[model samples]
Target: MPALPRPAAGPGSRYTARASTTRPRPARHTDVAALSRHLTTRDLWLARMLHEHRVLTTHQVASLAYTSLRSAQRRLRTLHQHAVLDSFRPLTQTGSAPEHYTLGPAGAAVLAAHAGCDLADLGWRPSHTGRIAYSPSLGHDLGVNELLARLAARSRTTPEAGLPVWLSERSCARRWGDIVRPDAYAHWRDGDQTLPFFLEYDTGSQPLSRVEAKLAGYAAFTTATSTRPALLVHTRTASRDQALRRRLAAPARELSLNIATSSADFTTSSPWGPWWSPLGPGDTRRTTLTSLAARWTPLGSAADLEPTDADTALTLPVPPLPPTPDAGT
Candidate 1:
C-alpha cells in the first residue's frame, strides 16, 4: 500500500478545523436578563454605547451604530421622542453651534437597566453631594462659571459696577494647607484691578482649620493693590457662617471678607437658639458688642432703662445679684 500514502492535508482544512474547534466560553457573570431589557433596536444601540463607554455623544453613537447622521438623529429623536430620556436641550456656550447631549432621567434609567446597576451605586450620590471641586476631567472652571453667573446676577443692579474676576485653585499640596477651593468663586475687575470672591456652600463637616485657611487666602488676595470686598455665602443656618463672621468681625478690621446671613434664598434660620455653643456657655450667644448695643439706651429716665449689667449679661435662669454701691452710683 506504499506505507498507506500519508494522508495529504486538504486545502486550509486542518487550519480551519483547528480554529473552529476552540469556541470561546460565553461571559459567565453576565446577567442573561440584560438581553431582554433593551426596548427597541435603537434602544439596544444606545444601551450598548452607554454600557461600553459609560457615556456617548450623538456623533459617537452615529459612528458606533454605523448609521447615517440622519439615522442617528432619528434614533435620538425616537428615544427621546416622548421625552423618553428626560432629554433636555440646554444652550451651548455663547454662540457655539454644536449642542452637547447629556443623559436625562429616562436615558439614565435605560442605561442603568442595561448595566444591571444604579448610577448612585456607581459613586454618584443624591442631593448635595459634598461640595463641587475641580474635576480634572471636566476641565472647565465650573467654580468660576458658577461664580460669574451669581456675581452678574447680584450686581446686575448694584452701583459699584461689575469687576473682572480671576479664579484659580491652589493646585498644590502645600497651598492646600492654607487654602480650599470652595464649590464656586467670583472675580471682579475694574480698571487694572481685580477682586476675587469665593463661595462656600457648607453642607458637610469641614474642619475649622480648612475654613480659616480659606478665609485667610481670600483676605490676602483682596488686600494688596486693590480695595474690594470678598464675600462668603452660606445657608443662613450654617454654623460656618457664624464661626467665620465672628473671626472676621473682631480685630481683623482690615479683612475685606464679609459673611452675610439671611433667611432668603440659600439662607435658613440657625438651628440652635441665639445662645448655644460647645466652646462654652457664652460662645454661642450674641456678641458682647451686639449685647452692649442692644442693652444701652441714651441714659434716659431710670424708668425707661432696664437694669444694664443684669440685662446686658446673658444670665442663666437663677437669682438676681445684689446691687453694688459703685454699680448703682
Candidate 2:
C-alpha cells in the first residue's frame, strides 16, 4: 500500500498542526503533585542552595549535592526537563562554560511549599534568574558563591572545622549597605564560639583599585559596629594578593582593620592552612583562621572560635551551616 499522501493542508490533522517546538511549563497543581511524589531530601537541599546562592554549576552541584558528576548531571538534566530546575550556559572565549542552575518556576513552588509559604514569599521571579546571565557582576557573583562552596566543602571533610554563616550579597546589602556593600558576610563558628567576618572576594577580572576602594567601607563599618571582623580578601593571583596587601596597608593602620590576603585556592587544606598573609608590619608570616583574632587583637577573642565541645562533632563530616549556602565551580 502506498503511504498516505493526501494528508497535506488538513485543518484537523494532529501531527501537522503547527507542532509546538517549545515545551510549556507545568501548572502549579501538577508541579506540586510531582514535587510531593518525585522530590527527594537531597533534591530539596539542592533547591535551597540554588535559592540562597542564586546559581551553581554542574561541578559545584556535584560537590555540594551529589557524590559524583554522573549523578549530578543525570539528576540535573531530569530536573531541568521536568521544570523542577532551570539553567543557562554562558559563552567563553575557549568555548562554552558549564550551565549554571537557578531556581525554576516549579522549583520555586516546591521551595515555597517546603517552607510553608506562598510562591511570592520565595522572592523568586523568573526574570531575576534570566537577568543574571546579562549582569556585569555575573563572574563576581559566581566567584563569591564558589568561595563559600569551597569553604562548605572543607567543613564537610574536616571534622574539627566549623561551617561558616553565609549571607549573600543582597543580604549583606540589606544588612549593612550604609557601611559599604560587602561582597558577602560570613561567621565561622567552632562549638559555642562564633567569629563573623566580612568577605571581599575578587575574581581577578576587576582592577585592584576597585578592591582598594571597598576597604574604606569595611574599615568604616568596623569602626562603627565595634565589631572588628577579619576582612578576608580572596583573589585569583599572587600579584593581586600583593597589590591588595599593599593597598590595604593604609586602611589597616589608620582604621585598625584586621585584614588578611590570600590567593583564591580551593585545594584541600589550602584555605584553613597558613595561606592568609596578615596585612601589616612586623612578622608577616601566613596565619591560620583561628590565629587571625590573635594577630589582630581588635577581632574579638580567639578562645571563642576553637572547637571545645570535646565530642565526636569533630570526628565526623557535617553539613554546612545556616541551612543552605550556594556553591559553583
Candidate 3:
C-alpha cells in the first residue's frame, strides 16, 4: 500500500496538543445552528403552503418552495425525521401519476401555531386557479345538500306538497348557458290558488356580488310564482355586524319579504334559529320579558310563578295573540 501524506498542523492546532500550556480543551458542544440548518427557507415555505392549502402534494410543495421535486421530497423526509411532520400518502391527479406528500399532524400543529404569517407579507403570491371544487359532485352537494334535507323533511311531512326537487335545471343565456339548480321548491293549494315557495340555503364564504346575484334570482322566481313566497336562509361561520344586518334586512322588508336573519343573541336556546321575523317586526317585544323570566327561573319550579292578586293588579294589557305560527318578529 502507498503511504498517504498527513495534514499539516497550524499554530492554532498546536494549542490543543499542549494541554498544560493552554486551557484544557473544552468538551465538544452541540451546534444549535447545525441542528436546525437542515430546515431551509424552502422547507418553511413548503410547510406554510401546506398549511394554507390544508393539503398538498410533493410536486405542489416543490413548486411553491421554488425547488426541485426531489429536493422538496428530501426536505420532507428530514422534517419527518426531526418530528416536525408525521408522514405522507399517495394522491393521484388526472393525467398524472400518483404523487405522495402531505403535512402530518406535527406539521399541521406547527403551521397552525403560526397561521397569521402570510405569504403576501413575505413577498410571495400563489396563482389564482379559480377552481370551484375538486369534484363536480362536491360542488353540487355543497350547493344543494342542506336545501335537499329541508325538502326531504317537507316531503315526509307532506308527500303531496308538489315540490319540484330537481338536482340540475339548465338556463339559457346569449353567450353561455348555465345549469341552474334552485335548492328546493314546494307548491300547495291555498284557497283555490296554487302557491309556490322557492328555498335556498347558502352556507359558504361567498362574495357580495354573488350574494346580490342570488337575491336577484330569488326576486325573479318570486315574481314568476302564482302566490309563492321566496325564502333564503344563509348561515355563516363568520360574524355578521349590525350594519350587515340593516343592509340584509332592508331589501326584504321593502319587498314584503318574510326574511329572517340570525343575530348575536347567543344566550337564547337554538342560538342560530330564526331570531327575527321581518314579516312581524312589531311582535318582537311580545316574548322578550317572558323569555328573560323563563331563563332566570330554576329548574322544576314552574309552580313557583303563580300570579298573586297584587301581581294581577300590576299586569299591563298585552296585545291579542295572533292565530297560526306568527313570526313574533
Candidate 4:
C-alpha cells in the first residue's frame, strides 16, 4: 500500500488553509496511473460483488467485507473521490436510508483489464445503472442478494456446508433462456450431498396468485427435463411460507418436481439449519440443505446424489444487522 500523506498539524498547519483567505487545493487524488496498484485484492473483490449484485447498501457491504463501519466509510469515500464507486441514498418515510454503492468507471475499468474483457462484457453501463435507484424491483433485488450474502457468510464458518455455485439472474437467463426465470441458481453442499437448486425470493409485494403462477412455470420446466434440481421458495413471513407450501405441494406432486419452502424472517435461526421444510402439510419435519435430497426423494433419482450425513451445522447464527451509515447525498 502507498503511504498516505499526513494531515496538517494544529489550527494553522501548512496543509490547511483558512477558507476565508485561501481556497484549499484538493490534494491530488489517486491518478489513473496508480489505480491498478492502489487497488488491493479485496478492493477488486468488492467491486466484483457490486457488479454481480447490482446494488448493495453500505451496511450490507461493510458487514460482508469490512471489520468496521469506519474503515468501510473511509475506503468508500476515497473510492468515490477517485470515481471508483458511485452511490445514492434513497429517500424514505424516516428521513433517508443508508446510501447504496455501485461500480464506477475506474473500478469497472480495472475489473475489465483484469478479466481481459471489455466493460460491456463485464456488465458495466452507467446509463443502465443510473435508472436503478428508483426501479420498483429494487427492494426485491436487494432482498435476493441479502439471502445470498447470508449464505456466503455461513459458508465461511461451516465448511461442511458450502455454496459451491451461485449464478445471478442474468447469468441464469443465458444458461436457461426465458423458460423459467429463477432469482438465482445455486449448488449447495451438505457433507457428502450436493444439492443443485433454484431460489425464488418473495419480497411480500406480490399477490399469492402471482407467486403460484411462477411455480406453474417451474413445474413445467421440471416436467420437461429429465434431471431437475429442487426449487426453494423463501418468503417474508411464516404465514406466507405455509400458504406457498400448500400451493406448491399440489404441482410438485402432480409434476413430480422437488421443492422446499422457508421464511426469510427466521430471525433467531441460521438459514443453513433446518429452516426448510419439504412442500407438504402432513410432513412438517424441518429439513437441512443437504437433507433436501432425502426429504424430496425425486431429487435423488434425478441424478447420482446419495444420502449424506445430516447438516451438522444446525441453527446457523445470523449476525447482527449491519451498522448504519451517515447521511449521504
lDDT of 3: 0.34
What is the C-alpha lDDT profile of model 3 across 255-304, one tens digit per residue? 55444333323212322123433323444321221232232222121011
Tens digits of per-residue lDDT for model 4, 1-329: 44223224421223221221132223553454477776655666667667666777766777566667766666665565565676767668985577677787777887777766677877678664566787898888888777766665555466576665666776566545557788987777777777878898877777877887887777666666656788888888999888787766776677666678888767224677788888753476777877776565556222222223521111111222222223221
Q: Estimate each model's TM-score.
A: 0.29, 0.75, 0.31, 0.74
RMSD of each: 27.5, 10.5, 26.3, 9.3
Tell me how far the alpha carbon of residue 17 in candidate 3 is from the true structure, in angstroms, after superposition.
Answer: 70
What value does the lDDT take at residue 41 in candidate 3? 42
Tell me how far the alpha carbon of residue 249 in candidate 1 is from the true structure, in angstroms, after superposition.
Answer: 2.6
Give the 10-residue window scoring lowest on summed lDDT in candidate 3. 313-322
Clashing residue pairs in candidate 4 are 270-316
Clashes of 3: 1
True-structure lDDT of candidate 2? 0.64
Error of 2 at 233 (Å): 1.3
Off by over 4 Å in 4: 1-33, 120-123, 223-225, 267-269, 297-329
TM-score of 1: 0.29
Tens-digit lDDT string for candidate 1 (114-145): 45566563333322111122123222333232
| C-alpha lDDT score of every prediction, in listed order | 0.34, 0.64, 0.34, 0.64
